[model samples]
Target: MPLTKEQVIETLRQVNYPGYSRDIVSFGLIQKLDVSDEMIRVHLVVRSTDNNVAQTIKRDVEAKLKEAYPAAKHEVVSEIQEPPQFKTTASETAGKEKFLAGIKHKVAVASGKGGVGKSTVAVNLAVALVKLGKKVGLLDADIYGPSIPLMLGVDEKPLYDGKKIQTIEKYGVHLMSLGFLIDNSEAVIWRGALVHRALQQLMSDVAWPELDIILFDMPPGTGDAQLTLSQSVSLDGAVIVSTPQDVALIDAIKGVQMFRKVNVPIMGIIENMSYFVCPHCGERTDIFDHGGVAKVCAQLETELLGEVPIDARIREGGDGGKPIVAMDPESPQSKVFLEIAQKMYDKIENQ
Candidate 1:
């Protein structure tokens, strides 16, 4: 069988963009492909501050090709490049039907990698804002993993207020998510294009009432959701969340750089699970090792918005569908998120 460029490209499509469900081919990450009977060569251009991204892509490309052609020689070249500004400035959205148009402030709560409590912070922060008497809406843009509905304890589908779907209110905050629209048990098996379109509909298709601000619980990674938000909407800023560890901080730093690269102001970073305090004994333990966020903030020149300790109360509240901030605003467990929310809202307002 003769090796062909088409076959090589198709095989490469199986390689997903490092942290996302999408492929490199769809993202236009494959810069060049050369195929012949003697050898197969591929060039990939990854636009990420994380150097590991390029290596990961190159490794995946080689592995796929090698599996397909065991006897053929292969060369994978990866180019690490900085992407041009990928955001729509406030000026660009003027006179345009950009989503987030009427809101006083538009913000995205994001993390490059998941499992660092990004969505947790977003949920608590939104509740905190409402407690502070700010009209707020939360859009669960994590189409693939919509948790807003579960975390906020809203079960019913959003009722239409005429032509547009009305946001389901919970804990005094307006909330919308695909999780609310579909069966919670059913998985959202969507491609990148569908995910992109869904985000548009989530933002522009629905009727979000005029409010002080809205926070987008962005999906993890620099994929479709982030791409759609950065290119189409005018975001006031973004709040990055991470754990107090090297792996999480590395991804968190990449997230901060991505927002900065696209001209999105980083409101600050929230070190979630920053530390764990003993319930039995009054002792503090750095479960994931502390002080990493301070170093990250110093290196990135961003603010350490606040630290959220690892507490059972937070988890219990989230799982129980009554976040601590809204349930007990005066509790210490809730104050971390509240303080961060206050800082974010005040920062965006001052801007």
Candidate 2:
């Protein structure tokens, strides 16, 4: 059989970053790969000041490749990228505190994969927190595909008064997203470097008022955005969102593991699209199969915060920019979000 790039990647998965349980693949260290029947090669960009870390990774990757393909020629090349050097003056440090001073807690609502309604949960949760009379801010961190503006029905750009960007206010929550700044016809095709800089500005350059918490509706997967956020702010913790299925749960597990590897607390797991209930008949059905997240929680030993059913009303609210939590607080769907928000707050305070 001919050697393939996918096969090489799968083989490299056996190599883990030194002292961490996660492999270099999930960290996105592998920059390039070339594979054929006779030769297999991989290029890695290691973000470590220690040259030993890069050399160890190269050695481990080469060993894994050779072990997997004994007869194939293996070449492992790596570029050791030391962390950036930056000088923060006293005034610059004070400026950072000025913008971030008002915030109390920063939480990231993230998913391992997309299409799991992660943003929906974030948008509604922020409003639900407001319903409890807690000041809240929602920073849409999905720069490539910012959806908070559309979901929160925010069409106008925020006020930028020379110094800082004042976030938009909607549904009793402060909001900021790349979607709000760009035209609807525009598409953001930013690279990793640009995405990192944008996230830094969104978090520290914005003039956010005093609030109970700031929920970062993170982009799916562990990529540049996630890396920048982890490094930029002192994150209180992270909430992983997932559906009740193997495919989705598979990525969900990765999300949890990634945070754990980074030493970030797992606030809890939210089982979205957990089940469906017939509105007319009032009979419940396990549309996506039930308790899959609970099973993952048990395996990961993480809290199962709450379950959000597959409700068309939730979808409609998300599409219509009315977030069911604020649009219909009396509804059962809204109550679930309300309860989840409270649970998140409690954990935040105690931890």
**Candidate 2 worst ten-residue window by lDDT:** 81-90
Instruction: Name the top TM-score candidate.
Output: 1
Model 1 regions lying over 4 Å from their true place: 1-92, 95-97
TM-score of 2: 0.73
Off by over 4 Å in 2: 1-99
Superposed by TM-score, candidate 1 places the C-alpha of residue 96 at a distance from the truth, in angstroms, of 5.4
Local accuracy of candidate 2 as per-residue lDDT tens digits, 156-239: 878989998898999899988988777888888887899988888887778889898999999999888887776666678999
lDDT of candidates 1 onward, in order: 0.84, 0.86
Clash count for candidate 1 is 0
TM-score of each predicted structure versus truth: 0.75, 0.73
Backbone clash count for every predicted candidate, in the order shown: 0, 0
Worst 10 residues of 1 by lDDT: 88-97
